[model samples]
Target: MSNINLKTPVDPKDAYVLVVEDNVSNFVLIARLLAFMGVQKCEWKTTGWGVVDFANTMSRVDLILMDLRLPHEDGYEALKQIRTDPHLQNTLVVVVTAHGSSAEMHKAREAGFDGFLSKPLDADRFPEQIKQILNGEPVWDLGI
Candidate 1:
């Protein structure tokens, strides 16, 4: 992965993030953003099923950037599996999708997402949103 810095004053290398998006463009965008944020440790999974498998193999996963709509399985189902898994139950998951709505946000919350971000995600605010999640803040509102 090419080195990119997304954070202004923060170094994200110390942090680890897993981005689960089926869309290649979206995955690239997320990976770039994380790199820009100074996140040196970032992994990618193209499907919900892949995410489950990856999570099982990973020793430490700090955060998960999950796409709401995906082939094979949706984010909701994947979230359910993650939450139910004894080992991964505590992993923080942030739902990322273009289908942003009050209902969807509520559903995400119900599914136990740690946070939510609308698609076409603002690169400018991406770092802050990540920081907020890491700080144990729930960013249910896109206004964050």
Candidate 2:
């Protein structure tokens, strides 16, 4: 869970970011990037299973960077649950998966993802990207 802080955002460094990825190494890299950007509050959830339930346990959820592939249900299913929840209906959700492709990006967009970011996330660009997303700017990149 995260405190997105979109409207009159506090600061990218202080935003609540939730990353749902099954890969430890990938999560580590993302964590390091978030830390580098001075993001103090970041949470981790390994799978799509019970994502909404887990998020309900958090104080706030500003953004969710979800992986498409997971041990349990896929990101689409998780996103569906998120959209259906009244508390989380307005939350920002983005895709961060290795399987970045035109078709996949289109599918994600059609599925109602707020944004799309391809992985191997660029450490240099990720912070700025987060800032843009938090500021309600569109950030749909194909990891190019």
Candidate 3:
């Protein structure tokens, strides 16, 4: 069984987060932002493929930020695997897609994403969104 540290529940500074995105630039920006916010634990996955298996190897995962359009499998498929996992049931998964349309957002919400954020993510506001998510608050910004 994977060990999880809950002394600081949902606190970004103490949380382990996974980012599933194919774009390196996007991932770098997100990692930097999280680092700036004092988040020390972070993981990266380029595709939704085997995401669940990958997550299983982690000692703990407080949150998952995923992108829809990927190289192989898509975010929805990965999300399905994550949602079905008993271990990751409480792990927050947010959709961070470039197609930040109303339709896509609605689809993500319906598909069971805990939160949604449109891409071309604003550096200034991204940290706040992450903070809210870490604090058990929902952020469904389309970046409009």
**Candidate 1, residues 68-143: lDDT per residue as tens digits?**
8989989988888887777677777889998888889888887678788998889888888887776666677655
Question: What range of 10 consecutive residues in model 1 has the weakest lDDT sum?
Answer: 1-10
In model 1, the runs with Cα more than 4 Å from the true position are 1-11
TM-score of 1: 0.87
- Could you report the Cα RMSD, in angstroms, for every candidate shown? 6.8, 3.2, 4.2
Ranking of models by TM-score: 2, 3, 1
lDDT of 1 at 84: 77
Listed in order, each prediction's TM-score against the native is 0.87, 0.93, 0.93
lDDT per residue for candidate 3 within 1-144, as digits (tens), equals 212223344777988999999999999999999999999999999999999899999998889999999878999999888888998866888999999999998888888888899989999999989988877777889999
* Candidate with maximal TM-score: 2
Q: Clashing pairs in model 1?
A: 4-35, 5-36, 6-36, 6-37, 7-36, 7-37
| Backbone Cα, N, C clashes tallied per candidate | 6, 5, 0
Once fitted onto the true fold, the runs of candidate 3 whose alpha carbons sit more than 4 angstroms away are 1-9
